[model samples]
Target chain A: MFFKFKNKKITNMISIVPNNIIKFEDEAGQYNFPIKRTLKMMDIMGYKEHRLFNDSVILSDVAVYGLNYMFENNIINKEDIDALLFVSNCTDHIIPPTSNIIQGKLGLKTDMICLDIMQACAGFVVGLLQSFMLLDSGSVNKVVLINGGTMKSRVSKKDRNSWPLIGESCSITVIENGGNNDVFASVYMDGVNSNALIIPAGGFRMPSSEETGKLQTLEDGNERALDHLTMEGVGVFNFVQTVVPEELKKLMDYAKIYDKDIFAYLFHQPNKFMLEKLADKMGMERSKMPSNVVENFGNSDSGTIPLVTTYNYGSLFEQEEKTVCFSGFGAGLTCASIIMNFGKLENCKLIEYGKNR
Target chain B: MREKILEILQDLRPELDFTESNDFIEDGYLDSFDMVALVSNLDKTFCISILGEDIIPENFANLEAIENIVKKYK
Candidate 1:
């Protein structure tokens, strides 16, 4: 339910978002939902524009692009990356994990640990938790943690609930040892309610079929097929609102840290509206928390937190040390958070996926 | 109290006329995110704590309903 990791610092965080942008107003015509209501919903949902992958650009491409940037910039030595943990829900195929695919493409060493963990929204923190545990055992000195996916691939053009809210990007973080164990993390899940946000079909439980692929309208006046990732927007909003403030209090209590001591609170930017509400409920100052990453790059799921880190606070982190807190909730019907002292970043770059790769 | 609540909700969702409509949730004018935000600012404005159970639809259906719940703490 709750955990802590110390003696490891997130040395660097690199983010990549596809070049394409999908405007909400332009897509409203396809939904046929009243334009007035659609625009209102977009404002309320904190969506303006979201990024989508260029067909050729898979989640791995953007992630590998960020990785390659880090290497070329002399931010990280490719050989020092021993453990490669890729956390994602949307990949090229279900059989061979995306981690192996990335390792193979990058030509990583055969002896390195390469595996994929299927996770969404809260992935970055979960990946950090796993990476910290791996290196704590004294086997490896550095770990490359990636949390990304071709998440927009799950968005059905027919489903308004997921339509405009889907934002895509990739985040790769480097974690290394010999730092103060000041980092604290907590991860929670509600499996019984996992279907509150899920892809009902395409998995073995109910494989994708022609029947599932056929679109049908629902009570909410939106259309979706069983094969697409369906989300109960209200359910997820309520789940996060009710659980996260308490989770934050627990995390602070465990770490013996208080709000006054915190320099920043970076949440996985689900959306502008959601983050605004959560900040109000948590009794936090808007400036103390950066909630605009979703608006800047769309809700690139796992990539959101790192994007916020590099986009908003990258420069600040480069100058001085700050007690920072991170929280992400979604997809798994899961939530994870970390409280750490953000130190100088040897390399934290927000790179765009170029046309070539 | 209703006027003050209106002032707060308006800041969160300036797109709609909250004072003109009584059917907030049903009309899709207010959903979960708005409800949380409305309740939060109300809690702050009225100095009342809104528990999870108090977050039912009827409580947030209209301005009058929100005022009624806020009156409970007073």
Candidate 2:
């Protein structure tokens, strides 16, 4: 579907990644591939250092830390937040929505709307879409959209297919009304192929068990269990290379945005290879798209797009306004994009989790 | 078509010969990233839109499988 909002704007954004770092070389021994092939694959896929939260930490912990940073820095007033949209793959509990937990923990006002959006990969864009909708309704003046998760908690350590790619971070974006330009966004979902990327167990459909948790080598020669997150690499790659560019073109066409008009294509970074291929397929220069996020901090699921924004152009965003586009795709087999005149943020930066605290 | 497919594969990983393995994906001759690059190259080269469902490892396992996919799309 297509959506255009005239008054919604993202005024502040912050991405917080855990301090613990894991280098690809250190964990190279865990994969199915030989050392030589592993190194070669690393070079090709741009696998390097990634941030993972320790087991004791959950999504809300880092999110609260980020929120506290924003509150303490005077970047935003806690009382002004009209809504809280916590978009994440990992939840504090399957019962009480994590958004409410965050709301209660932060001691924010009770009048605000609190929602927990169960989404991954495309989450940042999806969250932005919901926030835009809320702002358009005029019920909310400012929405705090938090996107991120403890992705590693869902990925098996032995599953080389996903382990090295998992990173955890939380991004808090303040979306409010009274914007200058029109915001164009689109969402494409293919639920039929949702299993292409999924956690086969842990829900009521297939409850987690000792059997489900039992690790076995899969066809790809990677060890993972039904309880762990699994991805059909080729399936996802094909989907991205084939469908994403087309979706992007539709949004660009609707927004009347061309290659030269965009300052950056801030996309959810799965890895260097996929992003490079996507950029190539789109017939755009690789420079216009940043693909170093996965290499530097791993793919933090839905947090990647905002992570890319702050990591790459945080300083620039604080000073000027530029036409930018954001796209997020994965699990749910969901793909979404947003194009807008973005910048001059009161806060656009990436802060370490505990270091900021 | 076979020669063209081989050329695309070679360009992606010039170090490996495409003919030696019956299963390029299983033998590690081609990885997921390679498949993506190869698929895009094939789409551009053959003017065929290979659907996402047709991109499994089996379809791109060998030259014959790849050619069959291209043929079907054609």
Candidate 3:
């Protein structure tokens, strides 16, 4: 779908990665021998370290930290937010929505709308879309879009595919109802490729059982129980390479914009290699597209777009606005792109979740 | 053309010896990123358009298979 949002604006965005840094080389040692070779492969793939939270920390804790930061720094008045939307594949409990927990923790007003969206990678764009929609109705003046909450506590220690790459993070984008700039977004989905990246068990479809919890080593050598995340890396990479560029081109063409008009192509940090290939296929300059987030902070999953945005343009957003694009593609075989005039993102800062709070 | 294809593969992922593995998919030598690079570079290098169907495991199985795909397009 194509959308041009005029009323809603992402005024500020702040992201936080936990204090704990999971270095690839140190962790790869546990898996043993092929460590050298695997490390080399990882190096080429543009992974160095991923941030993980201790057992004491939960997904909502990371999100609340960003929220508290925004409040303490006077970025936004809490009463102004009419809606609280939490988008993530992870939550504290399966029964009571994670948004409910966050709403209570943040002590939001009773009149506020709180919703939890169970989505992965394409979440940030979707979350923004939801916020824009809410604001377009005119009743809502502000919406707090929270992208994160997935915990890796369920990830098996033996699973290399997910452990080193998936970092724990949360990003808070404050969307408000005043902006003249146009926001163009395109979202595409193919549930046929849902299994490409999924946690096979633990859902209502196949409730987690003793059998489902059993960890087995597959032909690829990585071992993970059905309850943990399983990603068909190749399938996702191919999907992104094939679909992402096309979606990007369509969004750009519909807006009558080109590569030169964009200041930066902010993409989900699938990894360095895939981002490079996506940029190449789009016929865009590599410098215009940044992938340093994967190397520095690893894939923050659905939280990656805001995570990388804070990491790369944290300073830039504080200074002035520019024309930019954000794309998130991953699990659910989903792809989303947003081309918007970057307005002043007030008080853009990234902090270690545990370090401060 | 085959040498050029190998060169590009080697360039993309010089960490592992591309020639050593005949099984790119099963061997875990080349991943989807490598495959994307391979397709994009082969198109640019050989001046031949590689269809999406041509990006299967068989075409990228080994240096010989990659060479065959490139040669077919050439």
Candidate number achieving the greatest lDDT relative to the actual structure: 2
lDDT of each residue in A102-185, candidate 1, tens digit only: 888888878788878888888888898989899987888889988866765566886767777778788889988967657888
In the range A19-92, model 2's lDDT, one tens digit per residue, is 89999999988777665556555755778989988889988988888999999999999999999999987889
lDDT tens per residue, model 3, A208-236: 99999998977666788988888887688
TM-score of each: 0.88, 0.89, 0.89
Candidate 3's displacement at residue A329, Å, is 0.7
Alpha-carbon RMSD of each model:
3.8, 4.1, 3.7
- Candidate 1 Cα misplacement greater than 4 A, ranges: A355-357, B1-55, B62-64, B70-74
What TM-score is obtained for chain B in each of the predicted models?
0.93, 0.97, 0.90
- In candidate 1, position A106 carries an lDDT of 87
Better of 1 and 2 by TM-score: 2
lDDT of 3 at A105: 90
Q: Against the true two-chain complex, what DockQ does each candidate achieve?
A: 0.20, 0.20, 0.20
Model 2, A213: alpha-carbon shift in Å? 1.0
Residue A39 local lDDT, model 1: 64
lDDT of each: 0.79, 0.87, 0.80
